[model samples]
Target chain A: MTIEQGSYESPIDRSVFDQFAARLAGDLPRPTVVETMTALLRQEIIDGAYGPGTRLPEESLSKRFRISRHSLREAMRLLVHERLLVHETHRGVRVRTVDVHDLGEIFAARRVVECAAVERASDDGAALAVVRAAVREGQQAAEAGVWATVGTADLHFHQAITALAGSSHLDELMRRLLAELRLALHVLADPRRFHEPYLERNDEIATLLERGDRTAAASALRTCLDDAERQLTAAVAA
Target chain B: MTIEQGSYESPIDRSVFDQFAARLAGDLPRPTVVETMTALLRQEIIDGAYGPGTRLPEESLSKRFRISRHSLREAMRLLVHERLLVHETHRGVRVRTVDVHDLGEIFAARRVVECAAVERASDDGAALAVVRAAVREGQQAAEAGVWATVGTADLHFHQAITALAGSSHLDELMRRLLAELRLALHVLADPRRFHEPYLERNDEIATLLERGDRTAAASALRTCLDDAERQLTAAVAA
Candidate 1:
């Protein structure tokens, strides 16, 4: 079965499909077929196309991408390296499941990175603009009742916060952290209830940064992250 | 020529050789030949065996390991993923060079991780014991004038600090950060002068932590990181 047949189906799955259509329409560069496939599969996995513990059918993926099994393995290996997929000896490759233990550790990391980013975030106009734009995107998505897109926007908002620190290394760390976070968040039973409250908090933090109130911004972000971790932990435990 | 001929020869090179001898004598488990090779190469690179920009001789390495070119390639790929080595077209794989820009970004990440780790580090007896042990190791190495071992001890000190945060992810991030740091630090003119003074400061931070003075400990760490970054950036720029 394709990823669309996975246990957790999102309304925003079409957005990922549209990205594929756009890529095929020559809107983006494809360095190699394997890389292109890897990028798309990574997005699919992060977008919750395949829920936790779903076994990926190697034959079907190879056939679906019209690539050789060797190429498919290369793509899967990349995801495996990213910890988004796991290859067990006898079980083949399956989506990695995030446990409550992992959730706690991940949030600990997030608290360290995100709070620090906000504290040191420079008042660069371009960086702050990205934060505002992400907030706007999340607001619009929430208005349209698209929680998955809202989740993506929230990640972008955090990414923008890290960018304000002016360190690509931290930005990359935030990116990977959020991807794992997306996996952990897939366990939440009500996506709308979980994501809606964070939208306003994101805006509040962004506004605090815009006003040069970094102390308040950092404090707000720490609270936001703590609340999120508790909610995610409770959901994942269930 | 082997890695011993690399431009930056260290007295610690013999230490790496000793590890190889011990491995051969079955003092350590060889999970797989490729993994064994990868771990050895990773340690060598981080230990400044092959200095920054030193081209790794694929042919000699394959011969020395008695492994096929494919297995060597797999091992090299792992280091490449860790950002310890870069593979350029037509140039083969060589040790990655950390420039001024990269050094600045790396220290920024370090500040976020290490400082935050100190701020919230638990006063667990075992964790604090690791901190004191690493501090003692650095002091002993410094007294013996083994600056290279001192450097290793210094990294261990920081690694122990992050461990006190009780998150394996941050610990892993610190490992990668410190490896890249070793590459950047290879530019320093005097290893003794660079690592010597930090031994006392390491003791200071550990003492502060043991006293349950996390705020002071974090403050001291932030200052230490700032000074080191300034020194490293100046050396790298030169």
Candidate 2:
């Protein structure tokens, strides 16, 4: 049966689970099944293959993914906890819907964490080269009009800057925050309007860091964030 | 059957589902069973009621909490998402263990977010009074020698300050970071060491904010965080 028909008709099939398990053979290193499932779901969400508000039919997901009903449900629970998905009784799970307030929160958090990271990066042990490389990649992606690629690169550029703060906990927090923020970007109308200018500003911040001008680098990073926040607010509002 | 015995012998029972449904009757608002279970599990972890690295027997939790195996499993999935718990297929679930580096990362995040918040709280429109009230509560708790109470009050004081930054998102991020930090506190040898000094420092920062001295308040808050970080690091290292 086709995936959709199977989902509606029976929600479960023994062969689907068998295929899912078979598909997993040799595909991933011997990680736990839940981790493998999580990675797959994350990629699907990030790719916009699962549109916001559409229910992720558990049976279909299990059948197609070839994992047990138990493991797929567990993976869905993780996504829900991450705020990437929301689970409703009877209705099942759907990708979370992002609104204007969510955009503001995501960027506000980015400002607090990322700017501090940039300030920290200006010292001797900072990761200047990583930021520069990310910026270069962002510039290339922007020129190619691959807005999603450019957006990911821009996020990486900022993430690398934050990593200079030398706190893995902060890095992990920022990483989760960035993932949520990227979801909003998927629905944004003009992605280029948000990313193109950031490439040059990222370069400028890196240069300031290389010059050991922590204050200037931090100030520039703040301006960069404020500008992006304003643009995102306008885009999401529109 | 007694709770402990039932947990071991026939751990999955029909009444398990009934008890959860009854407790969630009309009064509490966020009505999802899985979410309620998640909150219960999170509280148990934070309170250190569940010993670290102890495998949470699913059947036992399901019976004791009087929740369906499916619902309990879903809640376990959320905790795993929060990194408060980890799940291994053959081994089942265990409370997550935080190391010295993890503790440092948690505090570093708090420092960045809280300092920014303090600066904002000193602004004209910010809610300084609310923060002052929470600080007073922390001081009172400390004076009473209620160290655990003081720890909780201290979290409230900082959360109130972060809320004054006028961003719900930042407040949520701060709350999560604080919860993770609390887990680290569970491992620390002397909880009183940090909370005792923090009560006084909270008052100092509050006074600075009341005077509308944003810079000084931010500076003082940073010092407070630095001191706490040092204590936590020392405890973890020891």
Q: lDDT tens digits, residues B1-238, model 2? A: 0111111234444464445456666585546777778876787689977656767887777777677788888888778867888877677888776667877777777777778777655364447878888888888887788889989998888898788777666787788878877876776556687678777788888888887887898898888888878877776566
lDDT digits (tens) for residues A1-238 of candidate 2: 0112112223445464344445666664466667667766776677776666667887777876567888888887888777888877777888876777887788777877777776655364437778888989988887788888998998898888888887776777778788887777766777777777787788888888888888898899989888877877776676
Q: Give the winner by lDDT.
A: 1
Q: What is the lDDT of residue A152 in candidate 2?
A: 92
At residue B2, candidate 1 shows an lDDT of 23
lDDT tens digits by residue: candidate 1, A119-200: 8877799999999999999999999989988988998998898788787777877788889889887777788999999999
Give lDDT: candidate 1, residue A160.
90
Candidate 1: C-alpha RMSD after superposition: 5.4
- lDDT (Cα, 0-100) at B37 in candidate 1: 70
User: For all candidates, what are the clash counts?
Assistant: 0, 2
> TM-scores for all candidates?
0.85, 0.84
All models, DockQ values? 0.49, 0.58
Whole-model lDDT, candidate 1? 0.80
